[model samples]
Target chain A: MMIPLESFHLAEPVLAYLDPGTGSIILQAVVGIVLGAVFAIRMFWSRICMTVSGIFGKGGMEKDGEDETEHSG
Target chain B: MRRSTPAERRLPSSFRDPSGFLFQRDGTLFRQVNEVYREDFQRLMRPDGLYDRLVSDRLLVRHEEAPKEFVDPELGFTVIAPERVPFISYPYEWSFSQLKDAALLTLQIQRLAMEHDMSLKDCSAYNIQFLEGRPVLIDTLSLERYEEGKPWVAYRQFCQHFLAPLALMSYQDVRLSQLLRVYIDGVPLDLASKLLPSRTKWKFSLLTHLHLHAGSQKRHADDAATGKSAKARDAKISKFRLTALVDNLQSTVRKLEWKPAGTEWGDYYADTNYDDQSMAKKQELVARLAAKAKPQSVWDLGANNGHFSRIAAEAAGVAAVAFDIDPVAVEKNYRQIQSDQRKDILPLVLDLTNPSPSLGWHHRERDSLAERGPADLVMGLALIHHLAISNNLPFDHLARFFHDVGKSVILEFVPKSDSQVRKLLATREDIFPDYHEEGFEASFGQWFEIEERISIEGSERTLYFLRRKD
Candidate 1:
């Protein structure tokens, strides 16, 4: 059974600049930057939540007390 | 200046990392840690306690500072000498359980990092190595000082590198895991999301990690301003949340499951065209041939679920390595061994046609599949047809390759008239005119002496035991 790579290629359909005929370095770089930004935003959104909570403190979206409890037993 | 010999230059686990390469000048193997990675390496070893804990737990390979005189000049980097691993395996070559264990270990390391205010910067499954039956994280520089509330920077990577392939294996089909061989970066999430059943959206982990994760990654991948730089994201996560994330991931990974059953070749021995009498005769012949080899170690190539591998294992308690291309078959075989506490047999995933290649820095660290073999005895039962028809390998070439791996071999031959061979020929052009018993015997005669041949009852296939004299 071949597992398909689904959403990783989602941008393939919408991009008008991804022409295979010409080696357009500028176009490719623009596309890359766009994709990279989206990846970065998703990664940092959780951090943004925590930063907002850090200012207020009482009910932060995340907790960071070093608990060392074995969760796998 | 005299240069190092290629054999001496070979270092284990070096080919996977491309930033710089690893090589050996003397007997000791060393990784020329490049300047590009200098800061990350220092942070991982110093301010972060990842190095110490990983060493203490035996989850990472230990290394020492090396003298300048023992370095390779061609590849520019400061060489830090390290201990070598006994053997190397690729992700596509790992059993389902093996891959699962490695994934858990990676998450465990990530969890461990939270306490020390560090995080795994990359989540490539290739970074993990198996040494002496244990999974050890090989990339020491992957850990970085954790930013508070950065929401696991390697999340999409972790999902791509581990979760997607695993989920596909569990849900769609186990063979899908082989996509790692082609993708190099792990299966893409968009592809996985499409292949998965619609019901997967209900599973929180799958939804969050696979579907929503892929969607978010796609939308924001272009928005560079959205991701906070290291200074901006420092809202320290309470240790409890860190632990919760780890626990949640562990539970999520554990819950994602698959059961192996009913593949064409999976339950082969039981449903084979052979009757009980023929099966017993064949088994007896195989035992006799393998016993004569007096092998200390054996490899059962194309060992579908390992029924014949057990026959060869009776050859004086030797270690038996059972290899199959099918993930489901390998998984089932491994699970059975684990449940039964079978110690002598090691089940692995392998595609005979396109085997594992040496990867990492300079291709020195991990040895390719062929570099690790040439067992005392290799059993290639019911495997010739696939190689002959499916792969279109000639008999002489197969014989020579087998000779390269082992001193003795046991092979099975199925005529063109046989149902199995006919099924294979049906799909493609039947250009193999010399793919019969006569051609097999003649080709193998150049390197081996036929010791015994047994015809499986209730079938047209024949099994041969041959000893390589060359």
Candidate 2:
């Protein structure tokens, strides 16, 4: 038999969220923060490396940029 | 107080869904859709086209609308009669590949639902059942119209039920799948995270879904208990992002693979003492006995790789459930069924000594192995000695247990002198003085009437066909 939401004190009328327990909510928050940071760092790391390399070799960097844009296009 | 008939009985496990619940009437199973789910149900059946596509694709069990008179009209919007599965199996009873396939099926159903502007309300592994040799979703009311900018609510459940256990089985040990039995809602993310190897954190999917997921759950739980508001953490995810999440999960599940090889029972046939002639003779005896009984369903106990269960299914035209204790053997058997598209045999991992038990709400939501059966026939080939000697189960107890689960039993008695029995006895004392053929018959004769007994030509083992005495 299916358990009723009222029994778990989770019946919020017309609300979209199905309360996934306090533990689950907390866990998702922590996980989101860590994953969000990782994603941010990875995305910026590539751009930062490209900028640093461009400072060292302007002509080579320009050629690489054209190749990248061509591949992306 | 009034006596409730079996037909009026509502399945306890089905009550979790306010949308609908399964009940039986006149020996037929029916689902009662509640009024609270009327709008979603209408959408599923009408403009959404979710029900039609799923039923046609054979991804969901087909159902027919039943008269309202079939159930209490006040509580039900409508009643539907779904095609009954021959046998119901749980996730814990499933082999690694079986669980993986079920997970993939759930994701595929979700993807399909999105195309119809619907989404699955929940992703419980119990909603999927192996029918016609493949996993099919049985919960008709689990689909609901999708709302934009809402996160996939069932994300944590899917990870807990499917991803966590799959990761543990793939990374830690295949036997860890037993944790599903203890954690009915799926393995606790925190526990699974701790049990998993540190190296798993390097894998992006594992890190995000399990390791980070576990940490978030713990922190949220602690904060909430302290009366702290964590509403800011509830991020609004676009439909595109949700679809991408589903795709990522599919890739993660697909990449997690387990090769069934090098296990003890997986290589049983190669090391068996029985020669080709004896093995063929044994198969013939089992097939002939199964044909004589003409059973509608058969359970092959300790069916290593289902070598003999196939004989019963093919020879008797009966649906067979092949059960073995070893995951590798069951994996190989399931792989064979998938490859051949065989519909008659279902291979599951089961340890007869500690079989699947009744669990969930008041221990009634799910059925125990014994509750699911009394199969028409049970084949126990070369398995008696293991229970008798290795596990210290007596013949009388084994006979009674078999009689309780089957009307007819086809068993093989391996003498103490047999190589396999000898190997079992090698590790322990020969305290079983009544382990001989005569002792075996006397004990089993209490519950079953012996019909036929045949000795293999080249082996010291004997096969008996017996019918339970009414």
Best by lDDT: 2
Model 2: CAPRI class: incorrect
Per-residue lDDT tens digits for candidate 1, residues A1-73, read: 6653331333221111111111112222233344445445645786677778877884636543233322111
Window of ten residues with lowest summed lDDT in model 1 chain B: B228-237
- lDDT for B470 (candidate 1): 62
TM-score of each: 0.67, 0.87
DockQ of each: 0.03, 0.11
Using TM-score as the measure, which candidate wins?
2
lDDT (10s digit) by residue, model 2, range B27-129: 8899989887877788788733889888887889999988885355666789899999999999998998889988888898888888877888888999999
Off by over 4 Å in 2: A1-13, A16-18, A21-73, B1-6, B222-234, B260-268
